[model samples]
Target: MVLSKVGKKINDYATLVMFSHTIFSLSFAVISMMLASKGSPSIHTIFWIIVAFMGARTGANAINRVIDAEIDEKNPRTFMRQLPQRMLKKKEVIVFTAVCFLVMVIAAAMLNPLCVMLSPIALFLMIIYSYTKRFTWTCHLVLGITSAAAPVGAWIAVTGEISWVALFMGAANTLWVSGFDIIYGAQDYEFDTINGIHSIPARFGIKNALCFAALFHVVTVILLVFVGILSGELGVIYYIGLGIISILFIMEHRIVSPDNLTNVKIASYGINQIISITFLIFGFVAVIVK
Candidate 1:
């Protein structure tokens, strides 16, 4: 099959950004959209929301990869990534990022005036996160806040406003994501430390960093419980899901310590995939079965 130029670009961009990971925050976005619409978002809203999400996620990842290409090249684990391997050029990535962000802008404009109005702030958050790791160990939190935008934006997209419910969900997502990031970043403890990159493990030592991760996840579960209580939208099923997710979070922390990162990828990527998917499933069921 002959691939057209655009088709090749799509393939490259997909590989460049590991587009599969879009599921992470997208699950929350979907949940927020469904809850905001009382379980049935219009197809039009759903379509545009998905488009906006894909663009934002891809654009953010591409930009991050570009910014960290040199760092990635130095780290053995990331040495083979597209940017570090030179399979994708920085200029190409910049163009792709620009195009993806434009898609987000277009989608937001289609959603509502408020969404359009807030698009720049969203973009700014995404862009600024790439720099955070350079200066702060709390870069994980920055990334979480950026990731949380998915759900919050979806809620705003659906209702054309924000609420404590969206904020709660965002906070839950923030801690959930940040906790996992601390775990994942621990895998690069040596590389980050040797290179002077600011990361939880690099700054606090891996054991204490894991402690921070555990603390963050505890807050995550609490915030989620609050979401269930405060929103009154999510019901017992979502709470049950949160309970299961809490167990998973505990397992995630237990299987990996600073000295034993053997299960780090499993805890971070494999189980994390299940966590997000579970959220999507139970979140949907909570709304549908409510």
Candidate 2:
């Protein structure tokens, strides 16, 4: 009976944090790790990196849920989420977030001094992102920057120093995530506007917001191409992966528009997952074959 109750609680927490969404940023982090190490980082490094990512991401999501609970409750589309629906209490989530951050710091300390020192900045970014939507339409960009830390942090974990390739990887992640977030935000446009929550779609209209998303993605692809060229370790396979990604991006954009966003969930989550996994495979192969 006790075990079952524990299992159910774990499931509830996972749902609260959308734990599966960890893949969205994790694949990019691993790709950057491989590139930074030229496919040769120690197993110790890999383990701690994954742990750190999970800790930070889980904590960030938990706190985001807590911070946005009222807004989420008011937004029809999000009213069913765990927090707003009361599947988990606010104090429970707060404790979970605190534990996650502690784990993150411990994992960082196990990795390297630089990672340990930078942990606070990462925590700050994660915490601050939840509040951005209340104040600025650039919230999507803030999210992108926050997500960029994953790849950049992974690179630092492997190399102990920042590099040009790391910056390019971070930039690519920033734009890619920002672009997709804009599309996702389209779903909440009306709610956001009604609640005075700033978002691109609410501020600029859905059609214009989508245009901005496309422009951001275009820059994302270019930045990725630059990452490949500048890394000098990635080549044909990597570019081929980018080709597939570009096609997916086009398909994603085609699926949703001002007139029809019925497929936004499919375009945002489903296609983005495939894109991230594709990059992970091709990126690893590119690093390995070189």
lDDT of each: 0.90, 0.93
Model 1 C-alpha lDDT per residue in residues 160-259, reported as the tens digit of each score:
9998889988998898889888889998988998888999899989999999989988998888788778767788899889888888888888899777
lDDT by residue for model 2 (1-290), tens: 99999998999998888887888889889989999888898999999999999999999999999999999898888899988888899998999999999999999999989999999999999999999998999999999999999999999999899999989999899999999999999999888888899999999999999999999988999999999999999989999999999999999999999999999988888899999999999998999997
User: Could you tell me how far off, in angstroms, the CA of residue 82 lies in candidate 1 after the best superposition?
Assistant: 1.0
Q: Which candidate is the best by TM-score?
A: 2
C-alpha lDDT of candidate 1 relative to the true structure: 0.90
Best by lDDT: 2
TM-score of each: 0.96, 0.98
CA deviation > 4 Å runs, candidate 1: 1-11
**Alpha carbon lDDT of residue 197, candidate 2?**
96
Provide the lDDT at 156 for model 2.
94
